[model samples]
Target: MHKQSVFSFISQLIWVYILLFSAVSFSQKLTSGFKHTNALINETSPYLLQHAHNLVNWQPWSEAAFEQAKSQNKLVIVSIGYSSCHWCHVMEEETFSQEDVAQVMNENFINIKVDREERPDVDQVYMTAVQLIQGRVGWPLNVIVLPNGKPLYGGTYQTKTDWIKLLNSLSKTYKEQPEKTTEFANRIAAGIQEKNEFGTEKGSVFFSKELLNTNITTLKENWDLTYGGLKGQQKFMLPANINFLLDYVILSNDAQAKKYIKLSLNNMALRGVYDHVEGGFFRYSVDTKWQLPHFEKMLYDNAQLLSVYANAYKVFKNPLYKERIEETYQFLNTIFKSKKR
Candidate 1:
C-alpha cells in the first residue's frame, strides 16, 4: 500500500509538470518577444488565429483587405490553407516567421490569410485560378491577386529561398509591366468563369458493359504495374474514382481491375505518405515510389481516403485496409476535430 502511494504521487507530480510546461510554452508562443500587428488577430477561425502572432502582416480575407490593396495599389497575396495543414505550418515557421520574408511581404503586398474551410467560396475561386494557370492545384495554395482581386498567378508550396525570389520577381514585374499582368489576370478570370460552363449538356446516354470495359482498359494501360499508382510522377490520393473502379470491378469480377486496385492500395499503404509515425496520410507523394509528401492533412482528403479504405476492407477483407481506416480516423479525432464539433 505504501509503495502504491509513492508511485501514484510520482505520477501525479509528472502530470503536473507536463501541464505546467505546456501552459508556459503555449503562453510564450502567443506572447513571444517578437511581435507584429496584423488583422488576423481579430479573426475567429483557428487557421487565421494560428497566424495571429506571425511577423508577416497577415490580414484575414475580407473586403477591407481588398480595399486596402486597392487603395495601396498593392498585389494581394492570398495564402490558402486549413488549420491542420502540415506544410502550412511549415511555411509559417520557415517563411512567414522570418523577418526578411515578412519585410518583403509587408512592404510589397497586401497579404491575406485565408482558411479554406471558412471561406470555401474564395478558395474555390482561387483554386480554379491556380488550376487554370499551372494545370494543377493543391494547398498551401498561394495566389498573387491584382488590386482588383483578380488572381494573376498561383501555385502550391515553395521553399523560403524560392518564395523570396518569386516575390521579388513578381513585384518587379507588376511594377514594370502592369498591362501584361492585367491581361493575364483578365484571361484567368475569364477561364474561372468558363469553368462552370457545360453549355448544352447531353440529356442522357445509355450505359453499356462495353463502355465500362473500355474505361477499365484505359486505366489498365496507364496503371503502373511496378509502382501501383497511375503511371506518372505524381501520387494524388485519387480516392473517389479509384474506389468506384474497385467496386465496379469487384461486382463484375474483373481480374485486371482487381489486380490494379490491390497494387495501388498496397503501394500507397506501404509508403511514407501514410504517416507511419502518425495515423493519417499526407496530401500526396511527390514521387512514383510514394516516399516524399507535401504534408498537408486536409479533412476532405482524409474523409475520401477513409471511404476508399473502408470499401477496400469490406471487399478484400484485408487487415491492412482495416488498420488504415481505423488509424486515419484516430488521426482525425486526435488532430483535426475541434472542441466545437
Candidate 2:
C-alpha cells in the first residue's frame, strides 16, 4: 500500500513538471523577443492580414508605399493574391517567411502585398502587365515595378533560390543600367495602356459559314487526339473552349466535332480532375492525361463545368453527363448553404 502511494506521488510530480515546462516554453516563445509586424498588420482584409507577421516587411497597397519607393528610388515589388490561393500560401510559408529572403527584399525593395479580392483595380493593372510580359498569368502574381507603378518584370511563384537570385540580378541591373530599365518599363507601360486594334480597321466586316468552319478546322489542330483536350501537359478545363465547340457541333452537325467533345467530356469525368468522391472538379490537371489534379477547387470553374455538362447532356444524352450535372449542383448548393451558416 505504501509503495502504491509513493508511485502515484511520483507520477503526479512528473505530470506537474511537464505542465510547468510546457508553460515556460510557451511563455518564452511569447515574450522572448517582440515579433515585428509589417504595415499589413492594421489592414482589415483577411488576405492581407494573413501576411501581417511576415518577415518580408510587407506593406499594404497604398500611395504611401509608392511614395516611399520614390523617395528611396527602389523598385517596388507588388505581390497580389487572395486568401484561398494554394500557391500564395506556399510562397508565404516557403519564400516570404525566410530570414535571408526577407533581408534582401526589405533592404532593396519596397514590398507591397495586395489582396486581389479587396483591390481588383490594382490586381487588374498588374495582371494585365504580367500577361503581356510573360504571355500568361497566375497567382501569387509578383511584379517588380518602377516608383510610378509601371511594371518592369512579372512572374508567378518562385522558389527561394530563384527569387533571391532574380531580386539580386534585377537590383544590380536597375542600379547599373537605370536608363535601359526605365525604357523597358516604359515599353511595358505602353503595352498595358495599348488599346485593342483587332477589327478596328475601316472595312466592311463579313461573317460566313465557310470562314467559321475554316477557323474550327484550324482550332482542331491544337486539340489532343489521344487524351482529348488541348495538347498541353497542364490542362485547364476551359469551359469557353468546350462550349464554343459544342455550339459549332450543334449548328453544323459536325460528326467529328461531336465525337471529340464526347471524348473530352468522358476523359474529364473519369480522370482525377473530377473528384469522384467530392462531386466537384479541380481547377486544372497537372498532367496531360488528367490523372493528377492541382487540388484547388474553384467555384467558377465548377459552375462553368456544370453548365457545360448540362448542355452536353441535352445533346449527347450521356447518362454520365447528367449524373455529373446533378452532383455538381449538389456541391454548389452545399457550398452556398455552408457560407450562409
Candidate 3:
C-alpha cells in the first residue's frame, strides 16, 4: 500500500478501538451504582434492596410501624413509591438521604416506606385519598396520617427544604393543637363514612342517544389530532372513551370520529408506550407524541386496551388493529399467565 493509504488504514483501526472502549466505559458506569448496599439488602424485592442504606430509618410496610407510631404518640409518615420511578429515586437521594432531614423525621415522626407494587391494597386506599384530597395523584406519594391511620395531609415528592419545613410545621401543629387535630380528624372520619354510605346507594339514570352524542363531543374537544390521543403531554389512553368513540363511529357512520379513533390508536401503537421490545403497553406516555414511557406496565391497563383494540378491529376489519390486539394477547399469555396450579 502507499504510505498515505497505510496511515489512513491505521487511523480507521484506532477509531474502531476508541468506539469499543467508549461503549465499555458507558456500560461500566451504568452498572457501578448496582454495587451500593442499603438497609434493603435482605428484602425480597429488588426495589426495597435499592434503598437499604439511606439515612432515614426506613421500615418495611408492617403493622409494627403503625403500632409504634400509635404507642409513641407520633404522627406517621408513609412514603410510597416504586423502583422504576425517577422522582422516587430523586426524593430518596435529596430528602431521605440527608442527615438533618432524617434526624427530624426520627425525632418527630414514625416513618414507613412502602413499595406500592408489593402492597397494592395499601397503595389504593391512600391513592384514593390523594386523588380526593388533592384532586390528582402521582408517584412518590407522601402522606401524613394520624396515629389511628386517618390521613391528614398528602403530597407528591418535595424538595429537601420544603419537606423539612413541612415536617417541622406539622410536628409543631400536632404538638400544640391536639384538640384541633382531634376535631379535624373526627370531621375527616365522618366525611369518609358519609361518602361510603353515598357510594353504596347507586342512582340509575336513563340514557338516551343524545347523551351519548354529548359525551363524544366532550371527548373530541380534548382530542389531539397532530400528535394523536387526548390532553397534552403525559397522555393516557382513556380506553372507556375510546370504546365509546368506536361504537359511535360504527353506529352513526361518522368519518371524522373514525379518523380521530384511528389516529389515537396508531399513535399509541407506534410510540414507546407500546413497548416495541417487550410487547406490552406502558402505564402512560410522558410526551405529547407518546414517544417516551414511564415504563411500569399494569395488567389492568393491558386488558382494557386490548379489549378496545380488539373491538376496533372487529368493527373496522383493519389488519393493523387486529395485529395490535394479537400482540397484546400474546403478551398477557406469555408474561402474566401463571402455572402455579
Q: Pick the candidate with the highest lDDT.
A: 2
Please give, for residues 1-341, the per-residue lDDT of candidate 3 as tens digits: 99999999999999999999998887566446653333454577766756776767777877888899989999999889888888899998888888899899989998888898898988877886677678878889998888888887788989999999999998899999977877776666666666657746568757998988887788779879887787775898878888878878878998888888888888888878897875889988888889888878878899999989998888878788788888888988988778783
lDDT of 2 by residue, 1-341 (tens): 69999999999999999999998887567444546677786688889878878899999888999999999999999999999999999999999999999999999999999999899999999999999999999999999999999899999999999999999999999999999999999999888768445567798999998999789989899888788888988988889889998888888898888888998999999999998986889899999999999988988898899889988999999999999988888887885357746
TM-score of 1: 0.76
| TM-score of model 3 (CA atoms) | 0.75
Q: Is candidate 2 or candidate 3 better by TM-score?
A: 2
Error of 2 at 104 (Å): 1.0
In model 3, residue pairs whose N, Cα or C atoms come closer than 3 Å (at least 3 residues apart or on different chains), thus clashing, are 38-52, 38-53, 39-52, 39-53, 40-52
Q: Hey, what RMSD does candidate 2 come out at?
A: 10.3
Task: Estimate candidate 3's RMSD in Å.
Answer: 14.8
Task: State the displacement of the C-alpha of residue 157, model 1, in Å, after optimal TM-score superposition.
Answer: 1.3
Off-target runs (Cα >4 Å) in candidate 2 are 1-34, 195-211
What is candidate 3's CA lDDT for residue 9? 100
**lDDT score, candidate 3, position 124:** 77
How far out, in Å, is residue 225 in model 1? 1.5
Return the TM-score for each candidate structure: 0.76, 0.85, 0.75
Runs of candidate 3 exceeding 4 Å displacement: 1-46, 83-86, 180-191, 202-217, 248-256, 331-341
How many angstroms is residue 248 displaced in model 2 relative to the true structure, after the best TM-score fit? 1.2
Q: Per-model C-alpha lDDT, please?
A: 0.87, 0.90, 0.82
User: How many clashing pairs per prediction, in order?
Assistant: 0, 0, 5
